[model samples]
Target: MSDMPATPLLDTVDTPADLRTLKPAELRQLADELRQETISAVGSTGGHLGSGLGVVELTVAIHYVFNTPDDKLVWDVGHQCYPHKILTGRRSRIRTLRQGGGLSGFTKRSESEYDPFGAAHSSTSISAALGFAIANKLSDKPGKGIAVIGDGSMSAGMAYEAMNNAEAAGNRLVVILNDNDMSIAPPVGGLSAYLARMVSSSEYLGLREFAKKTIRKLSKRAHNAAAKAEEYARGMATGGTLFEELGFYYVGPIDGHNLEHLIPVLENVRDSEHGPILVHVVTKKGKGYAPAEAAADKYHGVQKFDVITGAQDKAPPGPPSYQNVFGETLAKLAETDARIVAITAAMPSGTGVDKFAQKHPERAFDVGIAEQHAVTFAAGLAAQGMRPFCAIYSTFLQRAYDQVVHDVAIQNLPVRFAIDRAGLVGADGATHAGSFDVTYLATLPNFVVMAAADEAELAHMTYTAAEHDSGPIAVRYPRGNGTGVPLPAVPQKLEIGKGRVVREGKTVAILSLGTRLGEALKAADALEAKGLSTTVADLRFAKPLDEALIRRLLTTHEVAVSVEEGAIGGLGAHVLTLASDEGLIDAGLKLRTMRLPDTFQDQDSPQKQYDEAGLNAEHIVDTVLKALRWNEASATGGGARA
Candidate 1:
């Protein structure tokens, strides 16, 4: 608390209404204080930092000019909403961001009225804003729908799609393109600022409307030529011809950090009667923060850090992360096989495709924020005899399900899917958790889905997937570090649709999938202590059922339980169906399934999330005891206890 910067000006503002109460001269000081408060809060709690810092002045300007809750402001991706949150009555809980039972890392409509729409994925803000705008327009309401989206989000086609359909909302829709990457427009300066203010002003708009009316009275060809001339002339100077073509009145390339330049232009845009407007504002990522400015991506997401030195707390050394292991192994495999290639959707480092790119830059492709294209592209490559691995985060890959089904699965393409973050991810919460991949992919007819039990198994699976060319195969691994098993020197090519017995027994059987094998082994230890001879088997493949092994274990064991880190309709569901179809259930089979609950989990530690979901070792042991109907008197009776 003592290390926090003094926010004398920001302390007075609790909401946008309070921010509007301040004079125009006081805004510069308020923006400075807001930036400090954001840095301090993120430094204490350790969530997104650079994006929030980049938009500090823009956040202040938007809230100051617009009537917020009534105006309906939506932030694209919501990672930069920290500053927006702090100003909108969540500053008290700022330090609890991404923590258990604290503030979410992204915007939530339920959290506050200020957050009109919630988003975690990119490129959805424009569509959501359009929806709000149209809803208000139809109801004959006075509020506008304002969307603050970054340039990176504009890479997705959804933004343009929304823009194309925005004319229906008339003057109710306003899109602020926050260009932090400086990729779209040229450098912003005094001339551009003056031009932006002039173009958005009432006088300029009124004159333009009058000119349009006069031009409409002329011949159709002449009117069209005059309009194209005017639009292209402005486009050459402002770089907004594309947006103008999408039926929006384009303005700016203004300095986002300059309160003087930002507030006036925004005020003009607010008052103008334009049908649809796209304001381009240029701002530096990690602006005003020396350390973050030097390396924006490093500070984009962070752990708790020192505010003065900008030094983050390092996690203790542990086993290599599953992502890096997959990346390195793929890179190594690509060395011998000329056709081996890696593909990722926007996230190169997050999916470990960056390592592969380093070795085979020509073969590895980093497709920006376009999952559908990435899957189909991989499918195309696979169809032509090249072995392509489409490495993507499980939750993100959901965006390309149609492509996966139509382009790859239906055609039975040999696309190697390296699904990263395949289980519950800590801190990022339900939006980012990989809860449904196993359920979704296992249901596909021509899919081979495998889950790794440890780091070593992951290496083997990666190699195995590289070699397998029969059909579409996917290997999923969890987020964070793997179990510290030594990686195989020469990777093993495991037989398809098979499972291995890790621990042998005669009474109770624990069938594990994915990283939950560790918990299954712990449950075996607890069951052994309770006089139950427990057998723990890592059933690696979720699809194709590992039929022979599952049948052998189900018929022999007194009570068999399937444990997995996926939702309903995964391994447990398949196992239950197997038992039912084989008449094992009619023969008095005492079978139980353990899995994630039918509820979305909030942001918390991975262990706490799993504990809450009741998929831990203790829960497994309890499930086994309950299935056996064990009592204190008959606890040591083993299989006869039932």
Candidate 2:
């Protein structure tokens, strides 16, 4: 229906099997068409673009060579799976990427038989592929587990762990190292491609092995010298001894974008009897598209854009995002508090620490994708009396819970956890949601967990965390733009373990935590119009529970409702537990806890997600009405709990 690019080669094929029928040169043309289609699809939908562009030829090569569906192909992080998704018969739903009830942006097992594994997080592909490879081996299944991992993913300690354990899979595992950034070059195309094949040859493998054994028999000094020389020689040519030492038959450093190079290397690796091989295919991120290639971060993720000029649609100017609020606030605080420092796990920009890094470069640490290390590093800094703010996404913090419990909380160090994306993030979906931080952090002893209801509150809590040097404190805020609430000139230190009543009334008390405070106010307004008196309280601290405030509300109000933008174990559960423990329920208080449902929600609009979670104003009103009616029925002896 649209002026789509003529993809004759691509149109002829719906699956990877169709790719095998095309001529080798035609395959290159198909890759060009696929790249155009990918760019167009992402232009229409605005998902991950740079990553998929970077791996165009590699994806084509793998799918063309390997028998997928039978042979498991796992893409690390799944950001680059768009091209793979298109080739695997998911081309029809490419435009609905990250949308409600559409195809997922990532590879999903439920979406296609071609997707044997699902991935949204980084560095999990190697481990998953190893599992698939080993399981197939144990069951005598005729298939290979091929893992396409990136150089960036290698920075994580988990990738190293998987490589250490890769020997168990024998020759059943195939790891294609999709390296876009590294020291690589060798006189244009064909000659460099030849070196890749030579490095993988049996002659080289035998000679390298022979040299290693021969050198070991020499005198200690000569042995060390010879070993160093051999390593240097191999490193100069192949740059794969590290992988070889880890027990993988290293096979590459090929031109990932060149079909001439990519096809042969991939076919060689596919047919080889070797198990656990690493094919290092060099590529360029955001290849092809001029605008993406020219920009920094390579326009990694984008919004809907004009295809001809490559100008993306910019969001309307509004309040600063919650992430920038945290970053700028932390930076402002760091100016006075000389001890303050910021740490992020490979997400300096993603977590907004880049703003802090700009002014206080010496104080900002980008610890690269190791969340465990980032948490413990912050703890170590805190131990020495340095104020360290460990800025990590709520979902990513799950990776370092052991460190949070052992290193920071157990030691009672004041490592401030600045958690961004604290609620249902829209497009990135359930895997990236910050739904469990309140529940997890509140459960820890000596931990002060606070969720900011607005941008100004975030500033205040940031100040509070800086002043409180007692124990580990965490402040969580959501993903999007702030509520346009005017920021304070200098943040005032909030009273710990306390809450403020925004509106005062007699009949119904609505206790809200985090970003749901606005919805609570709306619900109150709706109730007020219906002649029901409603009171609203912003419970600033999820940990301290605001016991006095909660007790008074519980005793005075006819119905008490707890609401949070987190999962079931969070604010509502804590309030109910507190009310039960204090014996406040003896007054026949009608209590209701509203939270996200038990199941993980799919990617949808933020408003839609909150509605589904029953945290919206309408749901709040419905919940309050239901509680009041239940209380009235009990009073009349018509219905009562056992």
Q: List, residue by residue over 1-642, the lDDT tens digit for candidate 1.
A: 688899888889999999999999999999889899988999998999999999999999999999989999999999999999999999999999998999999999888999888789999999999999999999999899999999988888889899999999988999999999945885458999998998899999999999989999999999999999989988988889999999999998988899999999999999989869999998888998999999998999999999899999998999999999999999999999999999998899998999999999999998888898999999999999999999999999999999999999999999999999998999999999999999999999999999999999999999989998999999999999989999888888998889899999999999999899999999999999888999999999999888999999999999999999999999999999999999999999999999989998999998899999999999999999899887757454453455
Candidate 1 regions with alpha-carbon error over 4 angstroms:
637-642
Q: Can you tell me which runs of candidate 2 are displaced by over 4 Å?
A: 183-188, 202-233, 296-298, 630-642
Residue lDDT tens for model 2, 108-162: 8889998899888889999999999999999999899999998888889999999
Clashing pairs in 1: 170-275
TM-score of each: 0.99, 0.94
lDDT of 1: 0.93
- State the C-alpha lDDT per candidate: 0.93, 0.87
Question: C-alpha displacement of 535 in model 1, angstroms?
Answer: 0.7
Cα lDDT, model 2, residue 186: 28
Question: TM-score of model 1 relative to the true fold?
Answer: 0.99
